[model samples]
Target: MDLAQFKEDVIQYSKQIGIDKIGFASPDVFTEMKERLRTQQELGYQSGFEKGSIEERTEPKLHVPESKSIISIALAYPSKLKDAPRSTREERRGLFCRASWGEDYHDVLNERLYRLASYLKERYPDLQFRSMVDTGELPDRAVAERAGIGFTGKNTNLITSEFGSYVYLGEMITNIPFAPDEPVEDSCGDCNICVDACPTGALIQGGQLNAQKCIAFLTQTKDFLPDEYRGVIGNRLYGCDTCQTVCPKNKKKDFHNHPEMEPDPEKVKPKLKPLLSISNREFKETYGKMSGSWRGKKPIQRNAILALAHFKDVTAVDELVRLMKEDPRPVIRGTAAWALGKIGDWQGKEAIESAQMKETDEQVLDEMRKGLEFFTENV
Candidate 1:
């Protein structure tokens, strides 16, 4: 099969299969990025997730073995509607990010990529290929950047001049070799909109993100959240998009109006109270199909309680008191106690007094004392 014609067919098939952007790249485009991933991993900037698999992520050949070319595909999931009303307390419960409010993209993108891969197989019966969304050991964004689909932006998201960073990336690693395109020139010139908008200082430098400080990753991790990040968590129950929201490149693009990617009207910006009361069974049923549920109900529930604490809702004090005593997760119990204290209600004082006496971990006990102090100072 002719390489040029094969490349064109791949692009056409991706479009027919419903991908919005398609491009190609050589494995070598990863030279600098491989080093960066390694350095980031060593410094613990990868949040312990990259897991010494840096070599595989940097070398496509290690993944595909005979991979001579990579065809990168992008699918857009833009927010078409203006954010719904979240001004009232009741409306803020169970809120999910726009990308997660619908069916999971892993299912959607995999179904499309499999079809495209099958087409490639039928066309060139001897070709070997593998397709993946974000699940594989491959460095997806690096491959996408090399393919000229986009450039890595200061926010650490790949932003295309056309689709911005709102697009989801998937790729096909193949034995067939096509001439690769040069990487696109970055257009984020002197702009720090994403940097300035970050509430957690996750954007440390241009094109660099410390995932440890990233609210997005923090919300996704199943482990206990570090103490310093609690106050800045605010009302976000899942991922943080403040950087993307403020980018000029993202602002000018047409609203992402895909029906399948629409944010649930009930979830866009959640109220804190009802969210706190959701049962584990309810959490599984509501968020099981969504990507934000990767960390499960505990993190989202914890985030809600912390957001309530941040808001200092005196009305939530009784609920916090109950959670402080009843929740099994020490972190959750500690946060509930902290919120109750921040609210400084008479109920909070009782809850803090009870938790301080019963709590075993030094951290939880310390939080209990802090809650007691918050109430004592305010009382």
Candidate 2:
């Protein structure tokens, strides 16, 4: 097989099948990334969501033993929401970040990767390859960078020339020795915009991230949110976009190349009040298809309760009170109490005091006291 001609053919086929950008990379062990990840682990900055040990993550050959090359693909997602509903005084809305706006990118990108594999298999019937999305052990940004798809920005995203940072990334590791493409030139010199713009200071000075402090990571946790990040998260229901939205490379770079990649404005930016009481069946029916729903409705509901407090919507006082008093989950009950504390409405305050009488959980009781204390002091 003339590998060069076949690679061009593969690139053309990727364009035909909706892959926005594709690049080839040599399957060499990622030496630099291994060191950075070691430093990240030493600093206790890991998100705990990482699948494998440092070696499994950086060694492409471990994922596919015969891997001689890798194929990295990028599919651009829309940044600006078209005809998005306004967050008003009466009925405020919470937002899912741009990455979660469309269908679960995992499904979309994995499907595209499967198709690319199928095209390759048509000729090289015995080719050994493995495809991976975010859940895979491989570090996607590192793969994309080596494949010449994009450069890793200080915000830790693959910022492609054509699509900016608003792109979904996935990769395929195979034994085929496809010639590698040169990585995109680094254009982010002296740009501290994304790092400075991070609300929770999650972005460290040297482009490293402390996942514990990242709002995007914080929003996905099922437990009660840490006190400091509650205000910083604002009305985000799923993920935070502060870093990416502020990046100069991403300005006016929204791409609508794929139909499935478009967001349902109402769903992604839904009203916060109803979300607090949404039944499990209803929650699944509405948001189940989106990638943001993978963590289930608990985190979203907790964030929605907090979003109500962010807006200080007195109209949601009753619902917040209901959650504080009657919710079974301590995280939800406690988070509602915290929101009530933030809102400081009479009904919300009274509800917290009443709930404390029957609340047996020590943690919930502590949250209840915090709520009642909101009125005693200036805060």
Candidate 3:
């Protein structure tokens, strides 16, 4: 088999099938990444969402026996929303990070990988390949870095020359040995904008992230948000983009190439008040298609309550009062109580006082007490 010719053919076909960037890499052990992962684990900097053991994550051959090469692919997503809705005083809005703005990239990238695999299978009838998107055991960023898709930025995202750091990455491990591509040179020299701009200071010195302190990770948690991060999370409902948005490398990099990747501004940046009471079915029907909804409506609703507090949206006080008085979920009810206190309205205080008598949950009662204390302190 002329492996070089096959590699060329695969690259050409990849472009034809809408893959923005493609690169090949040997399936060698990712020693550096393994060490980094170990360090992150030791420091408790990892988000609990990581899927695999360190060995499985760093070694591609374990995932696919006889894996000789990895093919990394990237699809650029839009950074700027074309027609974003305004967040008025009466109608405050919350934001889903850029990665979750459009259709779930997991599905989109997986479809592209399936097509590429089919094309390769036609020529090599005995080919064995394992493809993975974001959730796969193999680290997509490490694979893409080795494959020359992009250099890893200080913000820990793959920064492609053509698409900046806004690209979604996925990879395929195959038995075929394809010549590897040269990695792009690291280019974040003397730039600390992302670290400096992080609201919670999650980005530690030397480009490392403390995921526990990251607003992106914090917003996804189902539990009550810590007091320190509540104000920092701001209007974010799902994920945080402070690091990416502040990167100089991503300057003016917005791609609307794929129709499926274009964001519906209203959906991604919905009014906060409506989100407080959105039914599960309606939440699913509206945001289920986006990557942000994967954690379900609870987190989003919780964040929406926090967002209303961030904006001090007095108009949302009635809805918040209703949530505190009647919501089934303790987390939602407690968060609403906290938000109402933050909003500091007379009705909110009155509702909290009323609910305090009826609230049985210890946490909810504590939140109600905290809510009333806001007015007490002010007085």
TM-score of each predicted structure versus truth:
0.93, 0.98, 0.98
Off by over 4 Å in 2: none
Error of 2 at 254 (Å): 0.9
Candidate 1 positional error at 54, Å = 1.1
lDDT of each: 0.77, 0.91, 0.92
Ranking by lDDT: 3, 2, 1
lDDT of 1 by residue, 1-379 (tens): 5879878877877787688888888865367877898778777788665533767777777767888888888888865546565444433343455557666888878888888878888887877888877877676788898999999899888898877888888888888787898889898999988898898898888888889999888877655567788778777788887888788888766545446666665655656777778887877786677777777788888888877777777778777888888877788888787778777778778868876777787777777887888866875
Query: Residue 157 of candidate 2: its Cα lDDT?
Result: 86
Would you list the clashing residue pairs of candidate 2? Answer: none
Query: Model 1, residue 243: displacement in angstroms?
Result: 1.1
**Candidate 1: stretches off by over 4 Å:** 80-83, 89-95, 255-257
Residues 236-308 of candidate 3: C-alpha lDDT, one tens digit per residue: 9999888888888888999988999999999999988888888989999999999999999999999999999
Winner by TM-score between candidate 3 and candidate 1: 3
Better of 1 and 2 by lDDT: 2
Clashes, model 1: 5
lDDT of 2 by residue, 1-379 (tens): 8999999999999999999999999889899999999999999999999999999999988888888899999999999999999988998999999988878899999999999999999978989999999999999999999999999989988899998999999999999889999987888899999999999999997469999899989999998898888888889999989889999999889889988889999999999999999999999999988999999999999999889888888999888888888889999999888888888888787788888889999888888888788877744
Give the winner by lDDT: 2 or 3.
Answer: 3
